[model samples]
Target: MTQQTENRTPERGTHVYDPATCRVGEFQGKVGPHAMLRPVGGGREWQADPGKIRRATAPERLRAGVKAANERAGRML
Candidate 1:
């Protein structure tokens, strides 16, 4: 872990936005210099700088939840 990663505290299920990739994910945990994030609908996880992470807005969270629900429904088939 690096000093910068320790500076910011992230909560579990913490929603974050990545302007660089125009993507969003839930903060799972911190690893080294990056924060671990899992996709909203259960895809591969990615690492990102904690410094650049920002909390997702209400609309974003709602959209993610709906997407996850739909994905799960599809998997039940």
Candidate 2:
């Protein structure tokens, strides 16, 4: 991990992108060496290396939010 990766740990509640999973999630906390992340609208959390994640971009966040809303709407029928 580079210095940036080694030193960066997103604050809790921040949105980050996990390249390994190609998904955006809210940073929950750390577990061992992995950062725990949850889906934007709330769902099961997954572990991702802190060294491999970056903050989510605006477009990414928008997409995730829309997807979550759609999912919820689908389930409401």
Candidate 3:
């Protein structure tokens, strides 16, 4: 990772993709060296390497939104 990438810290609530876990989550904040992220529509938060995560793409965000919606609909059944 370049120095810019390592120093770049996204603002809170921005959606970021963690390639290590192949998951998209909202940037909560940094915890020590790890960047914390919470799943879309709310769920458990996980630690991700700051250098390994980037802002989520449009389609990835849509997929996550759809999944959250489907999960909510399922619970309503």
Q: What lDDT tens digits, residue by residue, belong to model 2 across residues 1-77?
A: 23227577779999898999999999999999889999999999999988889889899999999999999999999
TM-score of each: 0.77, 0.92, 0.91
Candidate 3 lDDT for residue 24: 89
- Candidate 1 differs from the real structure by a C-alpha RMSD in angstroms, to one decimal, of 4.7
Q: Give the TM-score of candidate 2.
A: 0.92
Compared with the true structure, the alpha-carbon lDDT of candidate 1 equals 0.78
Displacement of the residue 73 alpha carbon in candidate 3, Å: 0.9
**lDDT value for model 2:** 0.89
Report the error of model 1 at residue 15, Å.
1.4
Highest TM-score model number: 2
lDDT of each: 0.78, 0.89, 0.89
Which stretch of 10 consecutive residues in model 2 shows the poorest summed lDDT? 1-10
- Report the Cα lDDT for residue 49, model 2: 84
Model 1 spans with C-alpha error above 4 angstroms: 1-6
Summed over model 2, clashes come to 0
Model 3 segments beyond 4 Å from truth?
1-6
Please say which candidate is ahead in TM-score: 1 or 3.
Answer: 3
